[model samples]
Target: MNSESLVKPCSYDPSFKVDIRSHEPLWCCAMTSSDVLVEMSALLSQLESICRKENEPSSQVSQQTGGKRKRHYSNTFQNHGMVLIERMTNLLQKTMSPVPTLLEYLESNSCAILFPRAVLYVKNPTAKHTPIKRAPMDGYFSQATALNQLISLCHQLQHDVTTMTNHKYIAHQIALLYQSINQLGNPKVLLDHRTSIETTFKKIKAELEKEGEKAPCLNSELIFWLQNLTSSLVQSVKTLSAELTSQMRPAMKYILQSTT
Candidate 1:
């Protein structure tokens, strides 16, 4: 999904009065939980294919040519692996679910692990590539791990919003969070959140437009609304994460066993 499509343009009109309560809900095409599962399965299959290809030995040939082919495949693997990582991240956040253990397993201790470094090198090919050494894995990535990370991030943002006096920064943060909700392709999940986001942001934009040159500051009402919105987001994501974990458990277990 194009990130640009997530947020619609907010047109400001001088005559238009901002009424937060009277705003209609934003509607979009609905997607089911089963559909999300199908998408996840497809991604897992593609990732698995890439992993298998990365591990395949180069065919016998002249030493120089063999090295070239190996490098070519390594580069290909890195590029594809990076794309999958991004897609997976977007999918997880969109579904309000955590990364599956099986997905992480397929990525660990493989060419997938090198994707981050590869990305850095791509940005600056002249920079020396330094290998990062880590201790042996104590545990695999799991749903709980991802959930904790999400909670931590939310808490950080919440703290920033509460303490920050800069209205523009706070507004930008709110817009970013609201835009993230639009990433939820599922109509069932998006409806309420989208409605809340749309009304709140429109009101804010209208207020800012009205203020013109004056410094923008959120009123108590807006602050309260933001708090409620964030609370709802956390609760919804938690519920969805649990549902996804339960639904995908069997499939994940099967994949892990087969890989072993």
Candidate 2:
């Protein structure tokens, strides 16, 4: 499926109410391996786009003294680059089982990582390098990794929305999260997350309306509300991951026996 199709429109009605406490089993319908593969590919494509946009030069200006031109990115772009770097580093650190060789390679070739920081003046020699050429060991691992990244992004979005005091970026983050969840190929989980996010968006809208300010900064109440929403999202994703692992154990065991 096209990755763009996974992103839901951010429009919502303030009157909408979402019931997040559904009794559906977390493992109601697990995605098949092929479905997982497609979703993972879509997610990787989205991540690659983000990395590309992050490093794209914002503007270029001629030098005052010389004819040379210098490339510079806006503060917003730089801040995003830093955040991407931080997310990647966090993912590496939080890996449940780390390979020493892989860690060494990533550290030694920082510029070649999946999401390298934006370099203003210097050109990256490994700009064309693609790190994740092939799929990971299994679809389960890929889905788990994507879910972890989604959870991390949710936390970052919460921090950014609260500290930045602006809800403008929240829509984009929600869209990305929706895309990630959609790629998981679990319709029920995706619907749950989408409902929760839309509910939160409406709450934010109501809060803004209460202050009679268009584009108003998020207040303390909204901040706490967002915190709870993000916590719920993280917990839901974790539960899904655990359920996925549980469902795949039999297949994993069969593969191991066959290989042995």
Candidate 3:
């Protein structure tokens, strides 16, 4: 049987009812033996014809793939080729009878190693720059309420995340980071979280404010805890910064570009 993913006569068939599963790419060894030869021969044969006519031995005819020799392609020719490949890929994706989203494909088939891919095109997107979908709750006294919730959580946190993978510290730090990210959904929540963080620092200072001898081990432990929290906060801010640059900036650019 022809291997090269077999061009599955199943789903693609105009007669047969397409199995939705078949829309997902089946893993197969790259076009092997005769298949590669057949495709290459077809492509090269077409390429040779174009080269022969354009070169003409006696004189060089002007070629779309800019070069005196007619066979050699320049950077501009390669750029156009890339653009053509991208356009064709997009067109094929759209034209397919049944297509799976990238996320859908990712959900299945963990055994196979998949190449990382990213697509960034704005067809229709919300213009809102802020995270509106999951903003902190609103009420008569939301400001202090949210602030208190975060600070209380901070007070309760003693690197405690026993629920994840039977680990204590690693998962605990990640959970704290997650909470910080969730809090960032609202500008006020982010501000509140930061303010609560300062309260945490102040508490440490208040404890250390006692005069005379400070226990070395106790002071060291507090220092380590503070370092971890500070590092997590910095890392979170860095992530938000990059998100602003990559996602928000491009979105705004697209808005302006389309408008102009």
Candidate 4:
């Protein structure tokens, strides 16, 4: 899908929690989960196995506090996660032939679903600053969503890397990706970017630093998710800007070097 036809879901606003389930919103077309089944069942099964193994066996209890305090499986689940990941790799290779590269889409291929009939205006011919239109937007957004599903694949991949291989390299790559998301997709970017999404983003980062000082412990994975997405998204503004500028370049310079 190209630019104009990208789906921009109403959820992107992040206003009061929206309940769009009754019917698909104006921007998004109708979709049933089974319609786009790309064969992820095998990988899901591997993940479930990992979860089961991570749980404390009924017999293997440790004596603590007074008796064995049931230790909830948190990060421990993935600590022993490798063999399953290899299986996931096999699933990816075997299934999903000629899959669309992007996971986010509107109808069939969108990640950020747009509101139906919502118009996003643009000023350029080659492209516009406007958001996705109905048709193409759905494709891109769907592709984006599909890409996101692969995160489970990646989690498995990382788990696999944990075994036999030194995890430092893989861990660092994962860390960087997560970090990029934070640096780019800051919440401020969503609300009132024209007023400085960059500044708002910096403020959010600063707050995180401060919070880290008080309660150093945080759901690092979720945080990683937030920041990683944030960083990657920062580039989007630049991309959009370039598209607009390039498309309007000739028209913009029409009056320049005029002999009149």
Candidate 5:
């Protein structure tokens, strides 16, 4: 099944209680309690065996001796890990108690989901920022959602500055992105250096545009100055993006490895 399909709709109550029966109900296939326990036990045992094999000292002995594992073995291990991850995630969805719904669990681990999307946006600059279009802007649902939007806008701002000739238009979009980021707030506790950059950006835009009004066209000198300004702004956004990712990565790693 598609991964997107696996994410069931979560209904919320005003009192902040989860209707667990409705959340991911499809996963609760009719089965006797004993049968479910047996199946879960077997799957857990198999997963443990695979993990043990992967973690064995002998496995690292090859690497320590400057010898790589055989290609087939490496592929097999990776496939096993993927299968186990899917199974475990499914099991968690199926078995979660109302005390902590899957949505709650996922929200607590929002950084896990956010960091990967952030990395994809940063590492692949040319890739389409698909999540940004549908991301929640309210900033209350999840930090991950807002970060997705911010990252996409940051990329768009960079692209616009580099490819668009209209400095005013690019600056306007940059201002919008900055405002969105500020409204989103820093849930990940990233060191905020954006205030100074944002101030500089506004000052530069105001000064440059005022000066440009005196000239009939954006001359070579003005163009050079605009290019430098755009470059600096892009760099500032990129720096913040990287710092936020770095702050969340450790938590993300823990969440990814979670079996419960």
Candidate 6:
């Protein structure tokens, strides 16, 4: 029998189906913020680790030396490869599937990691079906919200730069920063810094593009890219903080200006 025929087909248990109808929308108009970006980041790392472990060869010696395996041993590796492919495919699908609530998304087992603490903004789906009472914004104004988001974006960027394993994830992080800056009206000071940031990001992006979607190796150039990227992000955050301080306290701005 051919190697393909000798391998047994893998089976998987069906994922649990979430019943949206049974779950009422919890405060459709309410918006709750949490520091879940970093948590989600950690979850992504865990997923990558699992994928690597699953796809790894069963025997290092067999892989390195090209030694002949007994028929039964060969079969075991074949079975494992087949099962790993199926599991990884299912995981990809699950992670891509959209859910309304953070809780439901986690329960879906898309990530297949235990997320004990996730900071998330639970978006309500019921608002699409009907109008609901809007949440109060007494302490949460537009500028304040945008500033907070930018700060969070900087943190995410820094995290991605420091722990960059997959190029695709890093690309997503860069895109988030670009989108947020644009949404914030592309303030002049931020726009100036963005040029420097984008320059560093593009160099890293080019290197990653050449390497394709695999774990990156740390080289001197790559380290330099990461350091420059981190520095740019820190500068961006500082710029925003200063602007926010000026807006919140005009006297501070005047005092700093007079001192300068």
Best by TM-score: 1
- Model 6 regions more than 4 Å off: 1-140, 211-213, 217-219, 239-260
**CA-lDDT, candidates in order:** 0.52, 0.52, 0.37, 0.35, 0.47, 0.46
Give the winner by lDDT: 1 or 6. 1
- Order by lDDT, highest first: 1, 2, 5, 6, 3, 4
lDDT of 5 by residue, 108-134 (tens): 544224333332322333343333322
lDDT by residue (179-254, candidate 1, tens digit) is 5554444445436866877777877766555546465667778877777777766776677553434434544554
lDDT of 2 by residue, 1-260 (tens): 64657667988887797844332225534444343323323333344444455444335555683655444435674454444434343334333355233334344434222223222111332343333332222244566677777788888977787667557556566678767766666645456667777677776656555555656666777677667767777877767444545434533443444335
Worst 10-residue lDDT window for candidate 3 reads: 111-120
TM-score, every prediction: 0.40, 0.37, 0.22, 0.19, 0.33, 0.35
Task: Note the clash tally of each candidate.
Answer: 0, 0, 0, 58, 0, 1
- Candidates sorted by TM-score, best first: 1, 2, 6, 5, 3, 4
Comparing 3 and 5 on TM-score, the stronger one: 5
Candidate 5, clashing residue pairs? none
- Per-residue accuracy of model 3 over 69-97 as CA lDDT, tens digit each: 33333455334334433432333343225
State the lDDT at 128 in candidate 2. Answer: 36
Give the poorly placed runs of model 5, Cα more than 4 Å off. Answer: 1-141, 184-192, 211-255
CA displacement after TM-score superposition, residue 169 of candidate 3 (Å) = 6.0
Give me the displacement of residue 252 in model 1, in angstroms. Answer: 5.1
Question: Which runs of model 1 end up more than 4 angstroms from their true locations?
Answer: 1-71, 75-157, 209-215, 241-260
For model 2 the TM-score comes to: 0.37
Cα lDDT over the full model 4: 0.35
| Higher-scoring candidate on lDDT, 1 or 4 | 1
